[model samples]
Target: MPSAQSAARPAARSAAGVLGLAALTLLATAPRASAAEGWSLAPAGDGRPSFYAEGAPGTVLQDTVSVTNSGSHPVTVRLTGTGTGTGTGTGVPVTFAEPTVRVPARTRADVPFTMTVPAGAAPGDRSGTLLAKDADGRTATARIRLHVGGPALSALTVEHVAVHGDRITYDLVNRGTTVLVPKLAVRARGLFGRVLLDRAARTLPVRLAPGTRTGLSEPWPGRPALDAVDIRLTATAADGAHDTAGTEARFVPWGAVAGTAGALTAGAAVTVVRLRRRRAGRPAEPPPTDTYTDRDRDTDRDTDVELTGAVR
Candidate 1:
């Protein structure tokens, strides 16, 4: 029989083992913490994911960004604003009140900023980013969307129309404050007013931003070999944007012209050689002669007889 003291000892050891296993199971089931949960950046107030501003050109807009530090130590960060997208001409002009901020542990720092719409900025939507970086090379960013307000104008122009070897080239210019995906129509006529090329209007594989110019070409693999052509290009876009431009081109078959010129040159040389030969084979001419009639001979004899009688 075991003693009571030894039995109590074994029972206590078993309870201890069970408790240790339960503690390990609880730890394993708990959610793990993220490494980057130390600091964060976001828009100030209202739980908005990004900042938005709408204004006319030359208008100044204001907003705020928050930098929060949840770590035990203080965090020092630098803030910057960077613009993106084709609508933003140069960039989003972001000016921060405090470019550098130091936030104590478990505190948030709110920084104010102003974004100015460029004086001559076109009416469109632009995007940018607000960035916060710490000394450890850790970075956080918040997005910014800006819309420039102005009267929408839809205008475009077709310019510098020309014909290359087997293609027609031209430039499309956007003259309005809106984007354009222009459609092009090509027409070409020959010297005798004969339609050489007639293509219907179709969408082009290009997107033209405001105040931009793009050079493009159309293929003409079956163009005429010899003809004078008048090429016209018309570009049209939505909202009443339209323009047309024309140019003239002449195509000459130099091979055929050279062959004809060579034949003419050979004929001229043959004629020159024949004339020289004829002059060389011809005989020289003699001097001119005179003749008297019988009446003249009788008159001369009578004159001689009269002279002899006078002398006797």
Candidate 2:
């Protein structure tokens, strides 16, 4: 006859398959000491169903997992780890001292394992599953969460800013390790330094996760139709992270401006020419004529007569 542990493993494996990809919390079976069924698995703690550990990057954390055989037979099982979801990405590496172990009926086996955080791991939380599979394809699982320790940073940036129609679009990026709820402020100036828009910062509806980039937009219902404009945006987070960006736009009535300038130049030229012509048309004043006295003419005639007689 099969041992109690051997008979229980197959039934457990079949149950795990039917559960499908259930969440981590649902995967925890009964505690090692309180197994009501053929076999069970859990964290080494007396009351805890899952495992939680914290360490810095490049550090190795040690923990224990327990497999309890409640049935009347012995069971052999294999151990491994599986990523829960794409947490802080690729998941922290999990390794076991003994990959296979045998648990006697009504006995529990405690296995030691190491979770090594990668040297390049970002400061965040990651999750995985500690799985125990028996020879008969039955399985039991425990959830494990590892938190990489570091300073929480709130760096953020606004990028790819542009104006399309009456809307202003941009990309929000979280450059630091912490989650952020950002607030935005907008200001715009028109030709001659007129303040066209000045809106104070307001909380955004969405949250930004670390190392994530999301596109967002602001409305411009009062956009200028005939002036050059400068638009600026400022973003701020609760943790004092802030950034600013700007763009320029121009709206012009080309036809009207060209026509008006041409008309004014033509009128000024005509006025100048008319004024020059009037100055040229005026005649010069005649020189004052000296009254030649009768006496003077007689004297000149007598002198001329005397000169003529001498020559003869």
Best-fitting candidate, measured by TM-score? 1
Please provide, for model 1 over 86-128, each residue's C-alpha lDDT reduced to its tens digit, 9 standing for 90 to 100. Answer: 5524457888878988888877776767788889899887877
List where candidate 1 sits over 4 angstroms from the true fold. Answer: 1-37, 86-91, 287-312
Which pairs of residues have clashing backbones in candidate 1?
Answer: none
Alpha carbon lDDT at 84, candidate 1: 66
Q: Estimate each model's TM-score.
A: 0.77, 0.59
lDDT of 2 by residue, 36-82 (tens): 34888876544576877777888767666778788888888898998
lDDT of 2 at 17: 47
Per-candidate clashes come to: 0, 6
Q: Which ten residues in a row have the lowest lDDT in candidate 1?
A: 21-30
The Cα local distance difference test for each model comes to 0.76, 0.75
Q: Which pairs clash inside model 2?
A: 3-73, 4-72, 4-73, 5-73, 13-138, 13-139
